[model samples]
Target: MFKCFYPDQYLDSTYQINFEQLYAKGFRGILFDIDNTLVPHGAPADERAKALFARLKELGFGYCFVSNNKKDRVEPFCEETGGCCVYKAGKPSPKGYQKAMELLGTERKNTLFIGDQLFTDIYGAKKAGLFCILVKPIHPKEEIQIVLKRYLEKIVLFFYQKQKKEGNS
Candidate 1:
């Protein structure tokens, strides 16, 4: 029942993801969520994010930022990173994900989505038939709405972990 919220993979952070390995695994495009995924919510693009984008390009990966935030929040970051972006993305809805794939010029099977939220990022990407990766949030502090969502996310994650353990066993 909570399958829609399950991430295909979970990693410690976006920095920890092996882009080269994903490239080898046939994922040609990557769609990233900005707030808390690439940086803390409302934070600017950091050196690490810039370096990661450089590495992704070096590895022949196509990438774009897909964010639910308004243009004011997303534009400067994209400009700093030189990445295409879809702002106010309305995630968990397939429209933004499809638009991201179109921007990357990749088919669904070849696209991957990475974000810190399951309900928004993973669910939306999976719904769009793209592989999903969930990363730990960059900071524990969040807006009240996100804080509330995190409480519910913990319950979903509990079941997700149980299922993973059972599958392995």
Candidate 2:
């Protein structure tokens, strides 16, 4: 079964998430993956991303980016987006996620993780005992390795949808 890889919630875009509601629910920390999860891969943090982080801050939530991308990419993005980051994060392993939570001074029960990848982001966050939200990739032009993984993701997602439709999720 693909249950372990299944996200706590699957949504169309990270922009569509109701962070206010999440804050009201006592989720004070948010962990994020950069790249397609925010802007397109290799793109810098834009005004939209900056605004969103500002809004999250106003809502009294702390955020940290957990990215597999090297420090060169993650550091500037994190700085521009108004949050901290753990670069070269080995995702699909809970250590990075746990470290991000520590940086934010958050507990597992009050943290959420959002990203575009299932195998890395969702699985790692789940292992770290954080709520995971899987968002559709922002752009389709990904690296060959990710493109290959998307094919497998589709099969797991098919079953995930079926389970959700049957109200078992």
Candidate 3:
């Protein structure tokens, strides 16, 4: 029942992801979550994020930022990082993911989604049939609603881990 929330891969941070390997594996595009996924909540893109985007571009990967935040918050960050973005993206709804794929000019099978939240990110990506990667949130500080979701996520994660251990993944 919780299968849609399970990430294809989990990592400590976006830095740990091997973009080169993903490129070789036939992933041509990526959709990224901004807050907590690329930086601390409400934080701007940093040097590290810039470099990562540059590397992705060099590797011929198309990418876009898909965030639930308003345009004001997402636009400036994407401007700084040189990325296209769709703000106010009501994730877990396929519209946002579809918009992102359109921006990347990629089909679902060739696209991947990376984010920190299982419910909003992983579930949405899975529903859209895109490969999903979950990264640990960059900071602990979050809105009360998200904090509560994190707690619920832990329970789902426990079962996901167990399933993996049993070779059911």
Candidate 4:
């Protein structure tokens, strides 16, 4: 069961993930979270964020942005990234993942979903049967809701780590 969350399926900071490495991993497509993952919550896209969008395009990867936020909240970034956006996506419900795939017109076997939260991003990806990559939030000050969730995430991660170690042994 622990094998469901493979170590290689995660990325530390979004910036640290090599686009080439993701392609090598059999991921021909990517679905990304807009707020807090690409930019600080409520902030516009930074230079690095814009570069990442361009980089994905250059790499020939099919990508989309699936955000739990409303249209007003996600429109700018979606425009900046030039990726299809699913507003009010209600992630952890698999709606966003399904919509993303529909927009990309691809299969889950060649796709990856990237985000900064376990409850939403990770869980949604798992439920959709796609590879999930968790990245650290772009800024700690961005979302109060995420800050609250992190407290619970620590406990869950602790148990997951222990379980993984025991299973490997």
Q: Can you rank all candidates by TM-score, best first?
A: 2, 3, 1, 4
- Report the lDDT tens digits of candidate 2 across residue range 32-76: 999899899999998889989999999999999999999999999
lDDT tens string, model 4, 63-158? 888888889878877787687788888988888889889999888899888898878888888888887777777777856778899887776666
RMSD of each: 1.2, 0.5, 0.7, 2.4
Model 1, runs deviating above 4 Å: none
All candidates: TM-score: 0.97, 0.99, 0.98, 0.89
Please report, in order, the local distance difference test score of every candidate based on alpha carbons: 0.91, 0.94, 0.93, 0.79
Superposed by TM-score, candidate 1 places the C-alpha of residue 58 at a distance from the truth, in angstroms, of 0.6
What are the per-model numbers of colliding residue pairs?
Answer: 0, 0, 0, 0
The alpha-carbon lDDT assigned to residue 112 of candidate 2 equals 98
Candidate 3 Cα outliers beyond 4 Å, as residue runs = none
Enumerate residue pairs that collide in model 1: none
lDDT-superior candidate, 1 or 4: 1
Residue lDDT tens for model 1, 59-104:
9998889999999998899998876899989998989989988888
Candidate number achieving the greatest lDDT relative to the actual structure: 2
Pairs of residues clashing in candidate 3: none
Native-referenced Cα lDDT, model 3 = 0.93
What residue pairs clash in candidate 2, if any at all? none
lDDT of 2: 0.94
